[model samples]
Target: MSATPQPVVRRGLLDEVTDRILAHIRDQGLRPGDRLPSNRALSERFLVATPTLREALRRLEATGAVEMRHGSGVYVRADLSRLIMINPNRLRLDGAALLDLLEARELIEPHLAEAAARNASDAQLDELAANLDRAGRALDEDAALHTANMNFHRTLGRLAGNRALAQVLDSLIDLHDQEQRHILTLYADRDHDHHVHLAILAAVRGRMPVKARRLMTEHLRDVRDVVIRALEA
Candidate 1:
């Protein structure tokens, strides 16, 4: 169970509340199965309206971070759904399954890119551009480069400005990341991934929605081919 969380200093957004809750978990060394304080207590502690706190917890639940047990209480969870939307560790990530995932990406991501091109703020685009540079510098080195690559995609999701679509994509991407853990830890085609992201970002930055969609489609295709070859070899 978690210790008492610190009093929230002032009002904040749902994301801020989520971050603070996560920080508290890390700080308190809360383990899976640890029970959290009651909903009423947390609402008062965070200095937020009950509805906002519930919304933040809902996000956490979506991420597999915490479980709400009716008539029981809330408890920490190991965050399995980062197999999600199932745990990646428990599922068979066979080639057929992987291909299906890529197919979903092919169908969904181009639309996301189009949306991002239409809606992304200048600051968001700039961050993605900077991530491309970071990717170049960290090429194929495991954690650094892989993280930068994922960040670029996550940034794209945030830029799309549709919360439901972004959240669904986030879960799908998280599952893929879990599967890639083994391969990336051993080897990464960071250069190839890096270049593809660069092209995709360029299209988005140029405010060309159709072009962004085309580039994203092609990028996902390349990734699918690469993964297939990796599995075969």
Candidate 2:
């Protein structure tokens, strides 16, 4: 009889270990509030050292996955989505920090657009096309247009193929969007935004990296001016 082959084993980081453990529970059809194996048992089960297992458990607790008791071992509490989102207002950002964030974006994003122009596949370009269509439809509605535009930029960031850069840009953009929504309350000028965005999109579509870079720079400049003018007025 043929023996069953062992699966290839891989070592994972703390966060990945936590994700894997949670995934195991889900795949096994474990119910909510199900008890995970004890730390020592889990370590043995996964063939990981106890310290690494402990680190994973700590992250799960912080993220509100499992609850600890004085005597009882850790048990799954609930899903992570139950954790509240942060209120932007409560986040402390000083003027210098805000400037730094903006400058960082300026440095990172222009090149990202350039890279997207150079490297994005036809499928990815189609995604951008879809986003632009949504933006065009939302043009008359400033808030909706703003959302579409935000998504378009985020899609471009993703096309840059750098996960860490994209994550940082997402966070900064989220913060900026929250602040700008309050400051730029007027509905966006549909006629103007459509043309400007389309021009940028065209450069990207044509694979004109330099032109795409220029268009992106101009678009950001216009946005910065409008936001500053609105704040000052």
Candidate 3:
């Protein structure tokens, strides 16, 4: 008798396809504006259904990693500067716009950090610590590090134990990601930034609410200065 054929394991369709495509692009070192294979071709190659492929592509597009043209094809979109949305109706960027947002963050985030230091439970602190570790690792890389750092900030907000505050912080962070990435690209040194983050973490871990508050306020101020200087130059 002939040996039985092996059964192939099917992964989670949409998520797996999305991840695989993203990984392929990264591993292949595909540049921004590189055209992706057609939907039908990609679907055939990946053995995923057309709908699943479409969903995967949609996710990429939503994340500012890909762009689709009606008469053209999908092109990689890697301009993080253009990714930030300050005003929906405006097509231009002004320094004031970024400063305004950062000012708001300075007003809210330091107090939130203080509150988190005061109220965070052991489990919550542990989670925040773990996320910070990941952020430290990613800081050496370019795009990936920024994404991870963004996630770290979002989680930090959540750990503050205020749902409303967390939601607002998340929205602001999301809106600022593009501009943040742009500014950081100029002056960001992973090692230095990581040390600053470590300092903030230490204060938080020590449960010195006032110290943590002050440290984070300083950190934001430094960030604003760096960003403004870069923009001015």
Candidate 4:
């Protein structure tokens, strides 16, 4: 049998244009909050139609790299230097897929919690404490509480001192942010969640790796159980 040749993949013009626009932003040293040229100007510069340029801008806007404001020009909203990016158009996962996501987190996050307990500095521990405090205050406000809770998990991942794992966790968290908020409503015990986070933080701050890992594992399992029940009901 003859060896099979790989199919040649061609990049779309839209992707090319998007890359050019991002390059222009970097080449011009544009930072977050810096305004880019007008749409007409960018279209002319990229030699693409107005619609094509708008589409490209919308793609960037969706990724948090830039913000498109009506009546005002496009402004940089994020650092283009990120190593990992989330899927901008990812749809909500079904019950099975959601369970898979939680399973993946359950495996990875507790290990990260252990790493954080071993390696985190006093400053990092204090920051985690502050985040827990924010979560405590936001217990009655769904949106704020969700943000704070997610931040705690994300921050703990980064404090683990493993860049690759941290980036992976970041993408995972960003991908399922909306679903996590929905999970919060399903779980429906804000005080309990806040206290669980506090307990995890205390373990991390105390430099108790075994305790931190155990607490994190218990917390995630509880969340997974909540989701399973919700699906069952």
- Highest lDDT: give the candidate number: 4
Report residue 162 deviation for candidate 4 (angstroms).
Answer: 2.6
Model 1 regions more than 4 Å off: 1-90, 184-188
| Clashing residue pairs in candidate 1 (N, C-alpha, C atoms within 3 angstroms) | 1-34, 1-35, 83-86, 83-88
lDDT: which is higher, 2 or 4?
4
By lDDT rank, best first, the candidates go 4, 1, 3, 2
Residue-wise lDDT of candidate 4 within 54-155, one digit each (tens)?
888998888778999899889998646577887667677788878888888899999999999999999988998898889888888889999999999999
Candidate scoring better on TM-score of 3 and 4: 4
Instruction: Please report, as a residue range, the 10-residue window in candidate 4 with the lowest summed lDDT.
Output: 2-11
Deviating ranges (above 4 Å) for candidate 4: 1-17, 40-55, 62-64
Per-residue accuracy of model 1 over 8-126 as CA lDDT, tens digit each: 54445888888877877787888899988777888787787777787888878877899988899888997632333545345766878777877887888899999999999999999
RMSD of each: 10.9, 11.9, 13.2, 7.4
TM-score of model number 4: 0.80
CA lDDT of each candidate?
A: 0.78, 0.74, 0.78, 0.87
lDDT of 1: 0.78
**Least accurate 10 contiguous residues by lDDT in model 2:** 79-88
Q: lDDT of candidate 3?
A: 0.78
Q: Which stretches of candidate 2 lie over 4 Å from their true place?
A: 1-99
lDDT of 2 by residue, 120-174 (tens): 9889989998999998887667688778888888898878777677767777776
What TM-score would every model get versus the actual structure? 0.63, 0.63, 0.61, 0.80
Candidate 3 runs further than 4 Å off: 1-93
